[model samples]
Target: MGCFEDLSDQELITAAKGGSDTCFGELVDRHTTTAYRVARSITGSHEEAEDVVQESFLRAFKNLDRFDGSKSTFKTWLLTITRNQSINIVSSFRRRALKFFSDHEEGEPELEFASNPLSQEPLDAETQLSLKRQYHTMDKALKKLPERQRTALLLRSQESLSYDEIATVMDISVSSVESLIFRARKKIIELVER
Candidate 1:
C-alpha cells in the first residue's frame, strides 16, 4: 500500500476500481487541496466549498466506472465535477434567497476570498498593507466576472491547468477557453485600473 504513493492517478483509479479502498483514499489525499481550491473559488465560502468537495468526491467515486482515461485525466474530470457541484450549490442558494427576499433585495452576497497564510517570511507593515490592498482590489474584480469567465480564469491561473485541459473540464473548445481567459484578464485589468 505504501507503494501506492508512487503510482500515477490512472494507476490509483485502476486500483480503486479493483476494490482497493486505500488506493481511493490515496487519490483523495492527493487531489483534495486542488478540489477544495476549485470549489472555494466558485462557492466563495469555506463551508460551502467543503460541502462541494465532499459531494464531488462521492459522485466521482460512484461514477469511477464511467471514467475513461482516454477522454480526460482524473484531475480534470474531478475538477469538472467540483465546478459543476459548486455551481449547483450556488444556484440553489440564489434561488432560495430570491424566494426569501423579493422586493427589498439589495445585491449579491459578499464573497470571502481565501487568504495566503502559508507565507513563511514576515512582511513589514507597509508591504503587508500594500499586499492587502492589491488582494482586495483583485478580489473585487474577480467577483465581477461572469461565472464561466471566472471559472476559466481560476482553472488556468490558480490550478495551472493547460488551455486544453481547461477546455475539457469546461466542455468548451480550446479557442473558447483562450477567449474566456483573455476577456477575463482584460476585464480584471480594466477594473483594477479604475
Candidate 2:
C-alpha cells in the first residue's frame, strides 16, 4: 500500500492491469473525490452521486484493459466514465418520473438544492441572507443552461480541469469546449441580471 501510494496514475493502471488488486484500490482512492464531485454536478443529489460513482468505478474496473493512456490520462478517462454514468442515471430517473407523474396527473417533479449550513465566518444576518439569495439565483441560472454548456462550465469551474482535460472528458474539440463555457457564462449572467 505504501509503495502504491507513491506511484503515478499511469503506473497504478499498469499494475492493476497486471492483476494487482491493491493497485486498483489505490486508483479508486486517488480519484473517488473527483469522481463523486463530477457525478454530483450532473445528478444534483448526494445519494444519486454516490451510486453513480460506485457504478462508474465498477464499470471502469471491468474495462480496465480498454483504457489507453495515449488517448487521455486516467483521471480524464475515469471522469468521462463518471459523467456518462451520471447522465444515464439522471435520464432513467427523469423517464420514470415523467411516466409516474403523467399517470398520476401530477406536474413534473422539481429538483431542489440542499441548503448549505451557515458559513463559519462572522457575517451580519443581512449579508448572509443576501448571499443565500444569490446562491439560489445562480443555481437556477445554471439549471437553465443546455446540458453540454453546463457540463463544460462545471468541469472547468468546479473540477478545475484544464481545457485539454475537459476536452478529453467531454469528447469535444478544445475550441468547442471554449465556446460552450463562454456561452454558459454569458447565459448565467443574463439570467442572474434579470
Candidate 3:
C-alpha cells in the first residue's frame, strides 16, 4: 500500500483500471473523509452522510470505466457523485417527513442530535451549554436557506472548494457559484441576526 500511496490520483486510477483493488482502496482512503465532510455539510446528519459516502463510492467503483481523465480530476468527480447522492437522500427524507406530518396532522417531527462519542475532552457545564446553543442556532439558520444557496455556501465555507470547483461539482457556472454564495451568506446573516 505504501508503494501505491505516493502515486498521483490519475496513476492510482490507471492501476485500479488494471484490476488492482489496492489502488482503488488507496483512492477510497484518500477521499473518504472529504466525501463525508461534504456529505455531512449537506445532510446535516452523520448517519445519513455515512450512507451517502458508501453509496457514492460503490457507484464510482461501478462506473470507473466511464470516467474520462481529460474532463476533471478524480477528487472533483467523486465529489460530484457524493454531492448528488447526498442531495437525493436529503430530498427523499424531506418528502418522507412531509408525508409523516400530513398523516399525523401535526407539526414537524422533533430531530434528535446524536452526541459525539469520540469527543473525549470534558467541558465546564456553562461552556457546554453555550456551545450547544450556538451550534443549534447556526444549524437552524443554515437550514432556512434555499437548497442551491445552502449547498453552494457549504461547498465554499465548509468544504473550502474554489468557485470553479464548486461550479463543476454543482453543475453551474463560476459566476452562479459566486451569486449563490453571496445570497446564502446574506440570508444566513439575516436569519442569525434575529
Candidate 4:
C-alpha cells in the first residue's frame, strides 16, 4: 500500500495525463469534497451538487492536456470547472423557477430555497427546524436584494470564498467584491429586521 504523497500537483497531473489511472483517482479523492462544497453552494441541491462535481471532474480530465501549471494553480483550474458547472446547474434550476412562475402566479407559494441563508451553523436538530422557518422569511427578504447583492451574499456567506476568489468567480475587482459583500450584508440586516 503505497501513498502518492510524494507527488507534486504537476507530477500527479503528468502521471494522470500519461494514462496512470491511479494518479487520476488520487486526484479525484483529494479534491472531491472541495468540489462538492463549491457545487452545493452554487446549486443549493446536494443531488445536483454531486452531478456537478462528477461533471467537473470529467471536464477536467478531458481537458487535462491543456492545463498549464504556470498560469494558474491546478487547484484553481479544477475549481474553475467546478464553479462553472455549479453555475450552469443553478441556471437550469432558475429556468425551471421561471417556468413554474409562468404556469402559476399570485397563488403560487414561494418555493423554499434549498439553501438556508443564516446560521452560525452546525445547528442542532431543534435549531435546524427553528432556523428553517426563519430562513424561509430570510430567504424572501434576501430575494428583494438586487442581483449582485444576492450573489455576493451567497458567494461570500455560503461559499466562504475570499475576496480575491470571489473576484475571480465574479469577474470583478477585489474592491468591488468588498463593496458588493458590504452592500449585501447591510441590505440583509435591513430586510430581515423589517
Clashing pairs in 4: none
lDDT of 2 by residue, 1-194 (tens): 33457899999898889988889999999999889878876876677788899999999999999999999999999999999998888789685786677764333233333344575456666776777787668768887887789889988987789999999999989999999999999999899888
| Per-residue lDDT of model 4, residues 29-139, tens digit only | 878977776665565556777889999999999999999887665666777788787777666867578667787433422333343447534546776677778876876
Question: Among these predicted structures, which one has the highest TM-score?
Answer: 1
Order of quality (TM-score) = 1, 2, 3, 4
Q: Please list the residue runs of candidate 1 whose C-alpha ends up more than 4 Å from where it truly belongs after superposition.
A: 1-3, 93-95, 98-132
lDDT of every model, 2 decimals: 0.86, 0.84, 0.83, 0.73
The RMSD (Cα, Å) of candidate 1 is 4.4
Global lDDT of model 3: 0.83
Task: Tell me the tens digit of each residue's lDDT in model 3 across 1-194.
Answer: 33356799999988888888888999999999889878877877777788899999999988999888888878889999999998888789685786677764333333334344588556666666777788779889988888789889987886688898899888999999999999999999999998
**Residue 79's C-alpha lDDT in candidate 3?**
94
Lowest-sum lDDT 10-residue window in model 1 = 105-114
Give the better candidate number (3 or 4) by TM-score: 3
lDDT: worst 10-residue window of model 3:
105-114
Q: TM-scores of all models? A: 0.82, 0.77, 0.77, 0.63
- Evaluated against the true structure, the overall lDDT of model 1 is 0.86
The residue-by-residue lDDT of candidate 1 on 1-194, one tens digit each, is 44357899999998889888889899899999899888877876677788899999999999999999999999999999999998888889674686578755344344334445697556666776777787667878898999889899988898899999999999999999999999999999898889
Instruction: Report how far residue 5 has shifted in candidate 4, in Å.
Output: 4.1
Indicate whether candidate 3 or candidate 4 has the larger lDDT.
3
